[model samples]
Target: MKKVAFIFPGQGSQKIGMGKDFFENSDIAKDMISKASERLGINFEKLLFEENDKIGQTEYTQPAILLVSSIANAIFKETSNIKPEFVLGHSLGEFSALVSAGAIDYLDALELVHKRGKFMNDACAGSGAGMMALVGLDDEKVETLCKEQREKGLKVWPANYNMDGQLVLAGLKADLESLIDTFKEAGAKRAIVLDMSVASHCELLQSAVENLRPYLEEFLIDSFEVDVISNVTAKAYNTKEEAIDLLSEQLINPVKYKHSIASKDEDVDAFIEFGNGIVLKGLNRKITKKPTLNVSDMTSLKKTIEALNE
Candidate 1:
């Protein structure tokens, strides 16, 4: 069997109708969604299947994405016996990874991330929190510039180390906006401020870190069935104690996505992404030469099973 690592996508991958195919076709998916709706007291069928604005709200977005990702993984597992070498997720996707690793129950994870989103929203509310995407600039240069800005009392910090030439910065909206031209002049092909109210993966979220800890303790199991890569360290960990520490710290630390994939790519022959979109797959193309397949819907699910079986 081909050794594979399972990856999940974070916040930006959500859409209006993700996982509808699974819900419609698989009894397991339907039951999972129904149970999540009952567990959270929010109608997930309406939240996920029908068009609505709540899906975009941070509190709702986190769980919705996780539910769909979890459902995809569940349905895929029903068909394929191939176990992953490890599991990893980006940002909010880490909770999804934990669910896949059997470190947390999916129902508990749904509630955990829902509260996590609320904590993050409360932390950043009215704080002018925001993020910026930089392309074509070297990591060292971006880090240096952000450090200089911080020394000057700006809140800017590198948030997501997505790939070699791409990085995301989180800080006060005004601070990130003010540095756009600076990054552009420093050889960045593009430095655009994202339309985000939550400055994730930065000290701006320090408050959310503590707020999320108790829930992490309540939801996570003692150990993982499969090792999960940490976004904070780009290393693998399995115990719930480590998960609580790292996941809490993750709220205030930049995601080491590129480093995680590049450092561990050789351990797996390929990657299978179980989620709504191919967001991480796109990044893997640049981070490592290993093939990245996705299982988002029934068609892709069958295709991925077939490919992996061969």
Candidate 2:
């Protein structure tokens, strides 16, 4: 049997009109959007389709992206025979993965992500914290560079180990600036700052993690039917307790994505990036030379279905 995995993208992958295709064509998509609007008490549809880039703030973007991703996953389940053997998500996308795997209900996931976005936004307010991507550098070299910078009063650290030559760093604005020259001096191809407001996956998010603890404790999570990989530890989480704990700790812990992707079982025949963009597909290519598909729209979904059947 050929195994398939569903991968979900995180915050930076969100764009206006992400799920608009599915919303117009699929009843499930419409219902999911409507429910998200009612639960969050905000016009999620309007934010997704009408707001353009203005609503890309943390509070709105997190839930909006997750909602779009979940709808996409639902569409696949309803329309195709392609069942996922394993599911994984990047950063905030992990919530979507859990929902798709039947570990958490859609409403609970929506509310949790909404609250999580608010917590993250609150923690980052007035901190001058941000993220930057460093290209063409190995993980060890980047870690060493960040440590050296930290010794010089820079708070920078490896935040996302995205792929072989790509890593995201998070810390105070000044700290990032301080490392720019060093990054270039170390032969980095590019060291560009991302527009993210928070220094996520770093100690700066400890306050947000603390705020999220209560919600995790209160939510009723059950064991997942499908294997869901954890971003915090880069391993499969089987029990409800482990899932809840990983969800809470993910806020402040660095994403072990490299290990997670590298550890995927050899039985995986193809990888499908379930929503938004080709980010995960790109990362998958770095880890293994496998065929990867990206399904963010109806056309892509049809193509993927045909390809899988072939």
The most accurate candidate by TM-score is: 1
Q: Distance from true position, residue 171, model 1, in Å?
A: 0.5
In terms of TM-score, how similar is model 2 to the real structure? 0.96
- lDDT tens string, model 2, 1-310? 4578888899889888789999999999899999889988989888988856646888888888888889888889888867887899999889889888898888888888888988987888899999999998898999998888778877898999888888999999778977788898898999998877788888888888888888876654776788899998888886788887888888877888777878885758888888887888878887877788878989999998888888
Off by over 4 Å in 2: 52-54
| Model 1, C-alpha of 83: deviation from truth (Å) | 0.3
lDDT of 1 at 131: 94
lDDT of each: 0.94, 0.85
Q: Candidate 1: where is the Cα deviation over 4 Å?
A: none
lDDT of residue 75 for candidate 1 = 91
